[model samples]
Target: MYRLSGVVKRYRRGRATIDALAGVDLTIEDGDQLVIKGPTGGGKSTLLQMLGGLDRPTSGTVELDGTDLARLSEAKLTRVRAATVGFVFQNFNLIPTLNAQENVEAALVPLGTRAAERRRRAAEALESVGLAERRAHLPSELSGGQQQRVAIARALVKQPKVLLADEPTGNLDENMRDEIVGLLEKMWREHGLTYVVVTHDTAIARRASRVATIRKGHVKVAEN
Candidate 1:
């Protein structure tokens, strides 16, 4: 679960100060599914970064399970991210040289998982994502959808408590988009993950129990 209060993220752009998150107050419960929608420069992704402990806020607090991420040391934050959160991105962010299985195993490396256990877990993750047959394929060798599935496998291989996806289906066609979204939903249910996604697709928004619209560093949440 996440509880963000008075979260403010400010960046310096030349002489001007840009507030990516002016003051965000939000709560996400365990097993909750939330979709964040907003304009290009809005604070959606910034907020996601806060939740995932990928960035520190300029002011206020971002708490996950009662631990304030903003207060953690970099070493502790890295450990929390490695053990608690999973990320999927629009670009897939796979290493072109690494095969599907290797990319998934890479996630476990941060935890100092042994090679044999890493291989077994990565294979099971790829199988769960319907990519077992493509384990040996590199990112360049797979279709866009397949590549994204590999990304999903990599994210979930560690059995993270929360899944944060930013524009996960953005690069796919309509059919493929639907497939990926469906797969995400299935994984959320089966894994009991607290899912938060930033997306522009209205179809994906419609499926969420709650939708948040963020603009100009402000956020407004609505129930379905």
Candidate 2:
């Protein structure tokens, strides 16, 4: 479902150039659950951004379902991203002004879904994350886990084929982390969604079918 061939991303820092990703080559099949483990600034997030069409590669090829991302215009890429990827972040980037259901409904804007259908799907997504009762609550009214669940609901509302999660369990306590991880795995199985999760937490890393360790802009599979 996703492929990256010799993908590279470089950034200028002061007078030096830093390579975030150095010729990354990866393929993720449909329904695969993959984890990327790395220290801070190891390019795991950069790779996720590339996969989600949030950032363009400096030079190299990134393809989603066979369409080359490097060749796409920004508008075209945005459309592709809307249809293909869902993102869950550690910060749970929900709009403070909007309640849970409205936050999830925002994801449907690009898809041209009707308001009624959007609300219905948002409700269902929240239910999947065990947040159905909290739908009308604002982000500040909820616990950390509940806010994160709402973020997950927003991501899932679109029913994206690929779920790109960045440090998904970072802010929660151990019990909350476990709860979120369980819900994520359940959603993956029930929805047949492909996932690439970036995390520093060992427990979260253990849940993935495959784990790749990244360091110094390079990645390798860690032997069990």
Q: Tally clashes: model 1.
A: 0
TM-score of 1: 0.98
Global Cα RMSD, each model: 0.7, 1.1
- Candidate 1 Cα lDDT to native: 0.96
Estimate, for each residue in 97-189, the C-alpha lDDT of model 2 and write its tens digit: 999999999999999999999989999988888888999999999999999999888888898899999989899999999999898888899
Q: List the residue pairs that clash in candidate 1.
A: none
For candidate 1, which ten residues in a row score worst on lDDT? Answer: 38-47
lDDT per residue for candidate 1 within 149-198, as digits (tens), equals 99999999999999999999999999999999999999999999999999
* Candidate 1: Cα lDDT at 71: 96
Give the 10-residue window scoring lowest on summed lDDT in candidate 2.
Answer: 215-224
lDDT against the true structure, each candidate: 0.96, 0.90
Which runs in model 2 stand beyond 4 Å of their true positions? 222-224
